[model samples]
Target: MTNEKKKNTITWIALVLLTILSWKFSESLSGKMGLMVVILASITKFFGVSLQFLELKKAHSFWKFGLLGFLVIFYFLVFLFFS
Candidate 1:
């Protein structure tokens, strides 16, 4: 297999593992802690999908930074709204 395919496979596996981990954490942790953990995992998965599948890794720095900044505000708002 090609390197790109290998990377995608690894990323997919990682995302799956993270989802399972977050689910487990939700069952075991308190409300605030579980929310934080799940949100962190979601952010990670978002970046992975954006950079790899969406081809954002090759995007110009401005676009990349813009997405990052946008997500920061969005996630912060989400956390505030839920917490």
Candidate 2:
């Protein structure tokens, strides 16, 4: 397959693995620790989606950084507020 297709496939696989891991963590851990793990996994999945599916990897640095920054800041704030 082409490089772009390969990259997308890899990203998809990573997202799937991360989803499973988060689910397992949720089941194994309770309270704050589980929330933290799930949030971290979600942030990682968001980046993978942005880069692979949204084609943000080829976009300008400002847009790329801006999107990721927004995700991190928002998630962090939520994590802080809740925990």
Candidate 3:
């Protein structure tokens, strides 16, 4: 398989795992824990994508970081509003 296809597959798998983990233990986990998870995941994903962009010499690093920031903010707002 091509590198792009492999990367896409890995991304999909990561998303699926995140969704499943959230769905399975969301009730049992405290709001704070959920928020923490979201924050950590966002940061990790941001760094991962940033590194990939740097390694691949992509021109959209800024855009990717902006989206990541937006997601982090959105997640924080949701956590605050719900909790």
Q: Write the per-residue lDDT of candidate 1 for residues 1-83, one digit (tens) a residue.
A: 99999989999999899989988998998778888998899899988888887889999989888997799788889989999
Writing each residue's lDDT as its tens digit, candidate 3 over 30-58 gives 76776677556656655555545344236
Which lDDT tens digits does candidate 2 get at residues 1-83?
Answer: 99999999999999999999999998998889988999999999999999889999999999999999999999999999888
- Alpha carbon deviation, residue 8, candidate 2 (Å): 0.7
**TM-score (C-alpha, index-matched) for candidate 2:** 0.90
Model 1 local distance difference test score: 0.89
2 against 3, candidate with superior lDDT? 2
Best by lDDT: 2
RMSD of 3: 4.4
Candidate 1 — which residues are off by over 4 angstroms?
none
Q: How far off is residue 36 in model 1, in Å? A: 1.2
Cα error of candidate 2 at position 73, Å: 0.6
Residue 71 error, candidate 2, Å: 0.5
How much does each candidate deviate from the true structure in C-alpha RMSD? 1.3, 1.2, 4.4
TM-score of each: 0.88, 0.90, 0.60
